[model samples]
Target: MSPQTHINFTANPPKLHYKPHINLTTNPPQPLYKPTSTSVQTYINLTTNPPQCHYKPTSTSLQTHINFITNPHQPYYKPTSMSLQTNINLTTNPHQPYYKPTSTSPQTHINLTTNPSQPYYKPTSTSLQTHLNLTTNPH
Candidate 1:
């Protein structure tokens, strides 16, 4: 007779037999405790604009502000509020011969200086004559 061997095996893994109990009655799991008051306050503040902190003005910032106020050609310089008086002078003083003429005179000046030999000579001459007449008789 031939010899025979026998072996035994379990159908499921050991972990499946030891599953933890879950309480379906309760809502989703949450932290055991609340966050601190300061953390909560910081979260609230983050939702809005934070307060500006006080600090000494640096020399660079002061210089920039000064330059912005002083230099008329600077991009950040606000000429509207500061130079309104100058603009008024230009507009008002067009009637005065001592103050040159209106803003349009600059175009005539450019035409005379840059286009003296170009086809614009005739139109520029007519414009210059009109400007002279207007200046001589400001009414």
Candidate 2:
């Protein structure tokens, strides 16, 4: 009779070589939630001077209100009762169509600086010159 070799069924599993070379001192801790600004905007129909609707953030004390002007000279703003302040100024020549806009309120300042995670009202212009000038020298 030939001798037969029997394999052991209870052999140990192969070991995984894991290296712990993580640099704990090099990387800074990341923020869980980054800070962002929030603002509200009201839309106005240019074709018609009637106010369409007022859109705003669901939260309070962090809202910004804007009036969409179809014609820079002939502005059409809707009255808001949300207790938000309006701090907008635009400057233009008596003859030229171009104008500049300046934010006069603290909330406006925050909106200009931070990227508000809310809807913001923007004005429509026939040309790029009007857009650029309005922001710089807004009356």
Candidate 3:
């Protein structure tokens, strides 16, 4: 065998399985890495488990609530007039029957309060929303 052949030499270097070091000591702010419950539930409803990272959304915040309101994915974003009527109209227009309810007698008030037709009514069972569209638009 020639002297060149006998010499131990490597033409290519070994590839490194490189990975970034994580500092578990100091808590890193993970915005996108760990999504908020509001985001997960509101959007597509992610079924996968969250990574072992810090994200305490258990406590509610005004900022978080605002985020939900502004989010484009939220169902209440569009139909601005409807949202304003249902949510904002109460404070502005106190004369609204559903909001103030001055017409209904004491005896009938309880029954009307429980009725699903009322804007603030909460059905005992899971019921489909009946907007009573025919009230305004008659076919």
Candidate 4:
């Protein structure tokens, strides 16, 4: 019982179960092996089905219209000359009408468009007393 154990019990070698070599040769750059749509047992072989990949988003370059004033989480401010100036002086007797000190100029003027309904008084040329008490009667 020993001629190398009868040639290792009559030698039998041939078993490679995994046949897949498709080359229907019309040679246009073929070596494709694809199994990854985040692969988890995806072998799809209904005659190698692979022809569907689509992406389309466009209504003037991918549908986008955002102007929260150039949105930096929306809240941008710097606009004050009495909120972009809209002069309103509906003059009658909004507390004594006017004082014209455009000459004999002695100014300490901070009448940022004065409002008690347009009462801008900036005259200090050594007390040149100009007084107008328009006695309120504009009904």
**Highest lDDT: which candidate?**
2
Cα error, candidate 1, residue 5 (Å):
99
TM-score of 2: 0.15
Q: Estimate each model's TM-score.
A: 0.11, 0.15, 0.11, 0.11
Residue by residue across 1-139, what tens digits does model 3's lDDT show?
1011011111123213312111111012223222111111101110112221331112111010111122112222211111100010101122221222121111100110233344433223212121111011112
> Candidate 4 — which residues are off by over 4 angstroms?
1-73, 76-83, 93-139
Question: Native-vs-model 2 lDDT?
Answer: 0.22
Tens-place lDDT digits, model 4, residues 37-127: 1111101111101221231111111111101111121122111221111111111243324321122111111211223443332212221
**Candidate 2 lDDT over residue span 61-124, tens digit each:** 2222222221222222222222222322233444433322222221222111112342333322
Cα lDDT, model 4, residue 139: 50
The regions of model 3 sitting more than 4 angstroms off are 1-29, 32-64, 68-87, 91-139
Off by over 4 Å in 1: 1-72, 80-133, 137-139
Relative to the true structure, candidate 2 has a C-alpha RMSD (angstroms) of 29.2
Indicate which candidate wins on TM-score: 2
**Cα lDDT, model 1, residue 52:** 24
Poorly placed runs, candidate 2 (over 4 Å): 1-82, 94-107, 111-139
Residue pairs in candidate 1 whose N, alpha carbon or C atoms collide under 3 angstroms: none
Model 4, residue 98: displacement in angstroms?
Answer: 11
